[model samples]
Target: MYIITVEYVIDPGHMLTFMDAVLENAETSLHKEQGCVQFDVSQSHDNPTQFFLYEQFVDEVAFQQHVESEHYLTFSQKVQPAVVSKSVRHWYSC
Candidate 1:
């Protein structure tokens, strides 16, 4: 399995609104993408403006496909302006 984690630091004033958008995006991604095995989002308790997204795919190909998907593109475009900073990491399950 391919596991991906994304961390985001959002603008403080827009945190709640950004999370709402992310939640909707995650729902759409999990429902529309067959390659998506899991898609979860979490907020930091210590820093509410920080968010983490965990996603799992069947394999590299599945993940590549997801990156090329419309839903992913849409989500990116929608959240781009709201994000202050973001990082992504990829891992293969042992």
Candidate 2:
């Protein structure tokens, strides 16, 4: 599996909006993409503005498809302005 993990720090004022957009994106990706294996969203216990995403795909091509997906593009545009900081990492199953 090709795995992707993301950590995000969002503006406090935009927390609710960001959550809604992200959740929708997750749901849409899982339902619409054949290569999308798993999508998980997490919030930090200590910080309400902190969020994380765990995504698994069949391969690198699958991951690429996801980034180009309409839902992802919409989600990116919706949340970009609200993001304070972001980090992403990729991995493969052993």
Identify the candidate with maximal lDDT.
2
Residue-level error in angstroms, candidate 1, position 38: 0.6
What would the per-residue lDDT of candidate 1 be over residues 1-94, giving only the tens digit for each residue?
Answer: 9999999999987776787788987898788888888999999999988899999999999899888888778778877888999999999999
Name the best candidate (by TM-score).
2
Q: Candidate 1: deviation at residue 59, Å?
A: 0.6
Query: CA shift at 25, candidate 2, in angstroms?
Result: 0.4
Backbone clashes for every candidate come to: 0, 0
What are the lDDT scores of the predictions, listed in order?
0.88, 0.97
lDDT of 2 by residue, 1-94 (tens): 9999999999999998999999999999999999999999999999989999999999999999999998999999999989999999999999
